[model samples]
Target chain A: MNEQRRDVLDLLAEGKITATEADQLITALERDQPPVASSSDTRPRGRAKYLRVMVDTLDDGESGQINVRVPLQLLRAGVRLAAVLPPQVLERANAGLSKSGLPIDLTQLKPDELEALVEHLDELVVDVDQPDAKVRVFCE
Target chain B: MPQLVTVRVTRVNRRPVRIWVPVLPVVLVLAPVLVLAVLAAAAACRVYRISVARALGSGWRVISALPGTQLDIGLGRSAVLVTIR
Candidate 1:
């Protein structure tokens, strides 16, 4: 164990702090540590494995959760598949998305370019907390 | 539950988006499934609706009305997940 961890344990053994306090300290220490790339990701290096979005809701003492894991490969294939669609279809799709307040233009997306973009977005995570719910979006 | 919705925003995109995909026909292909569910409900089959509503909660219901059941499928740049409890 590291010195910091040992210290926490020692304090616990001496009854200077409760188990819960020791646990909280250890958790805070872990949270403060810098992140290191680990083999646990199990994905091919430099390629995103999944796009994940999670939502947790708590209302009136009831709780619910959502977990979504979208494969990057599926997205890659979907992009390529877009080529088979007629141009008008793509145009109309973009128009419809804009009307829905999500103005995305697929025509400008090239697979390679999108791959590079995804590489950058792999580190992106967005979280929202409402009175009774939490939503998170990210890639892994 | 807190009566007032306290909104907290945290943007933590630690990973870069490596790919983006379009989902067009997925909608059309999925449409028939909904139509069938609707027809089943219209046919006086409360099984589908009851299960779905219960899952979404008495306030929450979902597919087949299975309680505490969840189904999540992710494809391309999008994902669809549903749960009922």
Candidate 2:
């Protein structure tokens, strides 16, 4: 019924596009439409406050567990601290991080970038399950 | 609004130990010393050509954001937990 759908149909009727191509274009348009919210789901959404990491491992019949919750504000402060750090210190920290397989550059961190990173982190969830170990990282 | 931190430690064959640390009282007690330290840090930052105000702001932010953090670790029969609230 939309203009795009009508145009696709017109192309099909004029033999410019095959029926299969018209159908594909309509399906693609449908896929691109925004999702409609359901009336039954109306929970209020709040900004995430903490980043949590949990690990549980079993080795040689012994079990160990670790849980850590880090405030997102702390992470923001840390980035601010990086801004005040000496250039040499940032360089050394970056070198050490790179040596440890993390190639992050602290000198390039900005408040805006940190905000974007936190926003993305709010939707991130990682889970790793093994026969004897489990690891989870998420935000809440 | 967090004003305290509770730490609990338990060991095998030993009773668990719990301690509650009041943050406000500690901060009040150390206020004078903290002021002097900050002044000295500011002087040092001037010598190093760093921004004293920004450094102090970041430090305060880090301290203020410490509340609501939690850590828990357990191994075998020993466990430790720390919560800020």
Candidate 3:
């Protein structure tokens, strides 16, 4: 019951505004105000520890599955390791990565960029469902 | 902080075989060797005009981040699982 909401209700009670108008006004007020932060929303983001990949498939009464969990720290460390590599090696790596359909430049990978990528990955999820197969990738 | 790694393998109509490996003692034993290796690597990096501190730091980070990794593969009636924790 904020002041704006109370004012709207008071106007409705006093017959200055109709109930429908009061409802619309309150809705508008809520839309205009910034969302209140909850405990979880206030917490810092990118607390995820691992990236997981899961796959399950069934074929002709046979089933197959695979699961993998990789620590996010490992990715950070790998980027750091790449930072120390020779320029020629990095150039070769970039070429290979590009050839493999990933146009990432190892030379341009910085701690800040890596952190931003991890933060974005925190909210990334991929799922595929088929008649006899399922796949999922996410961070947790 | 994880101290052990567990590996399990199962086959159709057979009991699961589990192996427990203690990581802490192994890590402790290798600590000195790792320090020496880092020092040698740092010297090498210095010759190459690379940052010795970053190299050492990254190496340590990789090793320390090895725990909590897991992998599982299953086909038909056989399965293999590896967990570090």
Candidate 4:
């Protein structure tokens, strides 16, 4: 078994998480990790190396926050992909229009206005959409 | 002991090349021109190829912070900074 898979199983056995939770964690880990490449045709081998993206959520009062440390390569990829997406993706990903008059509100701007802003911030965004309600990715 | 593998390398000059060619029919001429345009554009990009072998060479270390939280990661002379909003 891979290191990530083994780590997940260890977590499950410790009763820190349920079996289903372990499966979900494994799936997410696999998506970011490629398979191991062995020199021989068949052998028990070590897990492949990869940039590990660790995501953690915290609740403070009524607000939720997340912090992530990603590899530079992954960061570059996200920045490139974010540059090409339509404004609707950002708007929809934010869940709804922000009532706060923060300069980041997209719904307040016209299509042309948003396009102009995107041209300037092409290097600062990433697009990682959440797959379920339990988790919402705030950053690319 | 570390084992080394040998591989052949091919180098291509970046300067535009001059070629003498026969004039083709109009239909053939347009297709070759479009093909050449695409090839030139593709060659112009500075391609950075990160092979899978290289990527899987080392295990990456990660550090993360939760919402309403902050963290700092470093090595050797290490440091940690946390500010909550």
Candidate 5:
């Protein structure tokens, strides 16, 4: 199978595209020779993995939590976003919190800690078929 | 029994990791900027470490109704664990 066809098939497998949409993709792939645009460095091709995040509002006081199923590429995106801000915000945010008598140290967090605490996220891809497994995000 | 509450879900964009090393000389040289820089770096780092690579690409709609205040998110045939709080 050609690269475009392979990508279309992969999207089909991921349940990202409908039967009609998949047909359109396949048709387009065949017609476009020499590839009008390279899939790489342009935009990723294929059905995106999905992550379901929810905030529950309950009488038991459980509404601030989020649960998500993330792809590795999305995880990388999340990491990249998290890295955009400087490191001291954590300390400053925590410092303010501490001043208010909350005992938490944001400066003491590791990469994994940040992942666990983040409320938002994104994704990336490596190959057409060899995508990584899903990541589970749970708020404790 | 605790009833299921309303849940909010927001999609975040991909970001890069930011690091700020506060050396004594630099800190002494730049106090206020150093603090701001540190804050910026930390925020960037947090964004970078987010678990995106392995996450689902599309944004998800939160279903507030679920089993006992807890959410049993469907991941295909399998389910993932989600706490209400």
Candidate 6:
């Protein structure tokens, strides 16, 4: 038996969860996973190395250029943690941001929407070269 | 403080490179300003908390019911950033 399937049965045997809950968990796990990735295949697969944000900057007066790489994983974990924030805190945060005349409101930002945005962020490439400075922000 | 951040020393030039920018010394130099800013922000939070309390204050109470509340945010490799509350 598959490990998750077996684990569910074991939980039922130990009286840890109700049968209904076990069924739902098993169903969700089985249904939600990607069918292609889970299938048995000999093809080599490439895993994502990093969630990368690279910013290359240059200032005319500076001795050397500066390159900044922001790990995407940090952003990912932050979003996951934000999911646990209390609704009251989020509401208050929205009010506080509004008071500062900022358009950002955390309360209205949903996890799914944020996830979609993050996925799109991987495609962003920003490049600018000006007389004073050259700035770039992109995902690698 | 050191000037340039040294990584594993791969490529000296070209490609996207990650360099760490330390903000502690600058923050320390401006500590007094930061403290005043914090005080002002705290006062604002208190006012907001009170106004929010008048409506549905249960959340603040719930947070306070616990011994204490502390929020920490840190940035590092792989993890990038973390916030613990």
lDDT of each: 0.58, 0.88, 0.87, 0.42, 0.48, 0.53
Which one is best on lDDT? 2
Candidate 3: chain B TM-score against the reference chain B: 0.68
2 or 6, greater by lDDT = 2
- For each candidate in turn, the interface RMSD (Å) is 16.7, 0.9, 1.8, 12.8, 13.1, 12.4
Cα lDDT tens digits for candidate 5, A7-120? 888999999998899999888877876656764546564444444444332323323333444443445445544444345656677889989999787566566766653423
List of chain A TM-scores, every candidate: 0.55, 0.67, 0.60, 0.25, 0.26, 0.50
lDDT of 4 by residue, A1-140 (tens): 78989999999999999999999999999898867677553534332222222332333322223333433433333443343334566677545544443436544545455445434332343334443213322222
DockQ of 2: 0.84
TM-scores for the candidates? 0.40, 0.79, 0.69, 0.18, 0.22, 0.37
Error of 3 at A79 (Å): 3.0
Q: Which candidate model has the greater DockQ, 2 or 6?
A: 2
Which tens-of-lDDT digit does each residue in B1-85 have in candidate 2?
4699999999999999999999889889999998999999999889878999988888889888888899999998899999998
Candidate closer to the true structure by lDDT (higher is better), 5 or 6:
6
Task: Indicate the DockQ of the complex predicted as candidate 6.
Answer: 0.04
Ranking by TM-score: 2, 3, 1, 6, 5, 4
Model 4 clash pairs are A58-B67, A65-B67, A65-B68, A66-B67, A126-A140
DockQ of the candidate models in sequence: 0.03, 0.84, 0.61, 0.03, 0.04, 0.04
TM-score of chain B of each: 0.25, 0.86, 0.68, 0.21, 0.26, 0.34
Docking class of 3: medium
Q: How well is candidate 5 docked (DockQ)?
A: 0.04
Give the poorly placed runs of model 3, Cα more than 4 Å off.
A1-46, A59-61, B28-40, B43-47
- Candidate with more favorable, higher lDDT: 3 or 5: 3
- Per-residue lDDT of B60 in model 1: 15
- Which structure is stronger by DockQ: 1 or 5? 5
